[model samples]
Target chain A: MLLMIPGPVHLHERIQLAMAKPMIGHRTKDFSEILEYCTEMLKKLFGTKHDVFIISGSGTAGMEAAIACFSKVKRITCIDNGKFGDRLGKIAERYTEVDVVRFEWGKSIELDEVEKSLAEGSEALAFVHNETSTGILNPARELAKIAKKYDALVIMDGITSVGGDYVAMDEWGVDVAIVGSQKCIGAPPGLCAVAVNDRAWEFYNEKCPFYLDLKAYKKKLEDWQTPYTPAVSLFFALQEALKIIEEEGLENRIRRHRELSAFVRKWVEEAGLELFPELNEYSQYSNTVTAIKMPEGITDKELRGELKEKYGILISGGQEHLKGKIFRIGTMGNVTIRDVVTTLACIERILVKRGIIKPVLGEIEA
Target chain B: MLLMIPGPVHLHERIQLAMAKPMIGHRTKDFSEILEYCTEMLKKLFGTKHDVFIISGSGTAGMEAAIACFSKVKRITCIDNGKFGDRLGKIAERYTEVDVVRFEWGKSIELDEVEKSLAEGSEALAFVHNETSTGILNPARELAKIAKKYDALVIMDGITSVGGDYVAMDEWGVDVAIVGSQKCIGAPPGLCAVAVNDRAWEFYNEKCPFYLDLKAYKKKLEDWQTPYTPAVSLFFALQEALKIIEEEGLENRIRRHRELSAFVRKWVEEAGLELFPELNEYSQYSNTVTAIKMPEGITDKELRGELKEKYGILISGGQEHLKGKIFRIGTMGNVTIRDVVTTLACIERILVKRGIIKPVLGEIEA
Candidate 1:
């Protein structure tokens, strides 16, 4: 079975086997060494000199942790263009006065609008680097520059972009960057990684819940440990996954993902499907996922059901307002060109069965 | 290495293998089935008819979630006797007005004292069923009865006791009980399980943090789903761990833990060591772990180092005030009589080498 969800894409066998290592005491020297080693690799993958920590949670946990610890400002600006972006805004609203700069779900973030919002004198600006809900990669670097001009700390939700795309937290001056283990890391789900720079540490809030407190995490990091017992198996998987990423080289990995995403997009167009996000000079499609409008007269449920039940291929349907209107295919993690081609073939077969399009003579094999 | 920590106990190979399962989309039917099956097994293990949900976090996350969702009352009483107990009280202090009933560490909870506190009209009584810090199993049934008499809801931290000891949440009128995956459940750390009874749901607060909201969890439960993406691999490990528990039978499993704890205590006595807790008829020692006073002239660091470096055995030292005064041995989660005996043998060997104890004749196999 193939899993092509926006996250938890697909794990390599090596990373999966790492989960089978025997349990070690979280306080033991062996685990300490492992924690240190994993932290180093994570720092490299994040392309940051800031401190990196592995949190035992999904991507949302990292987002909440960031909000819980750093949103002490009087007013924070959140750019919402997709589900994840809206989620960041909602979480931020709970802790501070939030100014939400909204955009269409499938549209790119307008730098001019964000610059205007930052001009309102906010302490922090939170945005999603890659909006998986609509397959749009926002211009995080440019937005961070505008935020820095206003002296606002930049917080990014890089869950699907960090590994698949070029996300340099330090380079972009992102104060806090959150990534998940299951997306492009090729690790199992259950671990969230966050890199926090010194600037972000200034806003630490002790009033935050202890479990999600960044200060507590920072203190524990001194001893190469976490405040709580993490999912040790997931940590092991992450370590192995990071090694794979290092061997592949981040640049090569980004290029591979770009090629795969482009290949998938080309297939979608040939199959008479349209990309959900509008393509323009400023619009950058996410390398990790591709959102496509459903063919006419075909419901998302029927298409995804047939893809799963008949072909053992699992893709994701639209979420929130876009539900049943579009579907998403993830080509992140260990996915290859063959996997994408096969998925496209399966979708074409299902579409043909539904009489949505005529098969190309050369594309259809005997 | 042998892991004899209070939690994150050694996992069985079968449970470890389950963590190696391929990634599945959280929305897939396969995942829904796994969720339903695992939830059912967890209910059986928890011995409660209440709703059980798997949270992707350490046990502390479950504690915070319970406090966030169920602490809408005017006042809640937290019975603080050990480190974990005090933690619960501290977390409760953050959510609502809290009345703390304090007791000495390594001491039992006096029901009369709790009754007096509950008389002040608390909406809920929060305490730890088993205090891992001091290896004391509080009288959960009696306390629950007293809380019920005052019409106060009962919230229990069963992190280290749920599967190792008898935890009849419904039978004892426990409204909410939190357990971790790495303790007697014999799964890796990362996932936390919470059993929430219908009565506790009445106090649900919308102001609670959305990520930790129980209402959202329940809404997703209708379709055997989590509101956010969960640690899927940990869920697989948990399913296998629960199956192992079912096969062993909870009664037999509890008895095994009791026997292992007893064996370790006997060895400590023979080695001229003393139990940390004051033993009396009212004093119920935890079946899952045992705390022993450090031998005279032997520092915890020295003793633990030798045990770990030479014998590859790992035990835990005390926390906070008890640090350097006592050490703990865990006898839960896939641990057998043989493992206990081996650990005891290693300790005896270390003591003999340090000239703290004379070697027993013929006791050494060599």
Candidate 2:
């Protein structure tokens, strides 16, 4: 069976085997140095010239840390376009007093709207780079530019963006960048990958809460240790995943993911179904999982169940209000164009046999 | 090499193989449900009728969570008699004002000392059962009973005690019980096991901090989920470890550990090395590790290093203030009397080689 959700994306057997090994001591001299070197490699992956720290929590945990580190303002504007975008808002609610701006679902943040919110609140701003809920990858670099224009610190939820493409943290004005192991990192869940710009660390240095304080972690990290006991096995697998990514060459890996995404979009278009998000603003990182609206007379639950139960393919149904209205598929992690095409072909069969859509061969699956 | 320095006690081949399994999607139905089951089993392992939550942190992280949760008061009194006791004091200082009730390094805590302190202050009392740092297991049940009398909730660190000894949660009247996977649980590090009683959860139900909030996690545990991504591989390995424990039967397991402790203590006395701590008031849970003061001129470091480097037996050299004074030989986990006899033979040889005592060995390594 092929799994084509945003994350946890498909994994290679080598990575899985590594995860299954007997766990080791996190305090041992052997694992400590492995941790030290991996952080350096992660810094390179984020394209940032700074320290990268790993937290033993999920992507949302990283989101919580970002808001905790940048907590000078009571009113922070969140540009939420999808499910994950709303999650960013949810995490911020724990720290910041209010969310100033929230965008519509399946829509990218309007630059004018962002600028207007920042001008009014003059506080911090956060949004997701690739909103997995609607497959709308925000133009963070351009958005960050607008944020910088208003002198608001910018942070991004790069959970699905990292490893699949170049975030170019330095090149973009992103102050805090967050990634997770389950996404493009090609590892299991339970680890949070965080890279904060020098500016954000400066912000954290000045005003931050206790638990999410990265500065406290940085001092401990110098010794290649977390202030807390880390998920040592995930650290082991993550180290291996990075090595594989490094051997694959970052550029080539990103290009392959983009190729897979494009292939899935072409097949979806050919199936005569309307793509939910604007085509021009689609995410290149996760292709197969787009917010696909149910065509007339077809419910998202019926289509997903048919494809999953009839064929051994696992795809994600839309989240929250989008449930029974939209379904999501993805070409992330170890996914290839072949897998994407095969999944589409399965969906096509279920749709036609159930009188939802006429049978059509996907480009690669056929 | 025999790894007998308390925990990471020793690894079986099957567990190591389990750790090496390829990574899985933690968010997937397969992985989420697997972890969900692991959480349920962990509660049973703790023998608690209340909520049992797993934190993807260290034994210290478990302690920190306890501190963070039941931190309703500013003054926390830590019962100190050894290295781990001081560590609790050190950790409490970071988040709260602390008071320390002292006992000597090689002595079990006197219940009178703790009772007297609890009567003076309106603060929670913290203590460790089976202090790995000193080979002295304090009478946690007695201490919890006294704390209950004073209306002070007890936070007990049971990292080394849980799997090896019979520590009844509800019967002992302990407010919060803490354990870890790496210790007597006979698994690896990267996870901590916690069981919060009604008394502890009462404090947790309020607007506690986020990362360390036991209440926030309690809600998630209702569905067998963590607030953040957990170390999935560790969770898998722990599930298997608990099954192994169940097959062994808890009473028989504890009995074996107690017998092993007596065997080593008897053998050490026969070898003419003085045993540290109160003989009657000791740790039966971790019977393998025995900490002894160095003979007249022999340093603890020389004894431990020679054993590891030459004999291929790894024992713990002392930590902090006890360094170069006491060396620890642990016999917990899957080690047996043969291991103890072999290790004893080596110790006798080393003592003779260093001219501390005459060589005497009636037992064979096999």
Q: Pick the TM-score winner.
A: 1
Candidate 2 lDDT over A113-147, as tens digits, reads 77888888766888888888887777888888888
Number of the top lDDT candidate? 1
User: Cα lDDT for residue A47, model 1?
Assistant: 82
Estimate, for each residue in B1-366, the C-alpha lDDT of model 2 and write its tens digit. Answer: 676677776666666667655545454566667666666666565667776778776677678778767777757789888877887887666556678889888777777777777888846888888788778777877887888887887888887788887678777787788888877777767688778888775555233335566776878766666766677777777777776777887777777777877777776666677777664453232453577777786877678768877997767767777888777777666667777777877888888877887765574122
TM-score of each: 0.95, 0.89
Query: Which window of ten consecutive residues has the lowest lDDT sum in model 1 chain B?
Result: B357-366
Query: Residue A172's C-alpha lDDT in candidate 2?
Result: 88
Best by DockQ: 1
TM-score of 1: 0.95
Runs off by more than 4 Å, candidate 1: A353-355, A358-366, B279-281, B358-366
Count of backbone collisions in candidate 2: 24
lDDT (tens digit, per residue) of candidate 1 on A207-269: 676677777788899999998888889889988988898899888999999999988887776
What is the model-wide C-alpha lDDT for candidate 1?
0.86
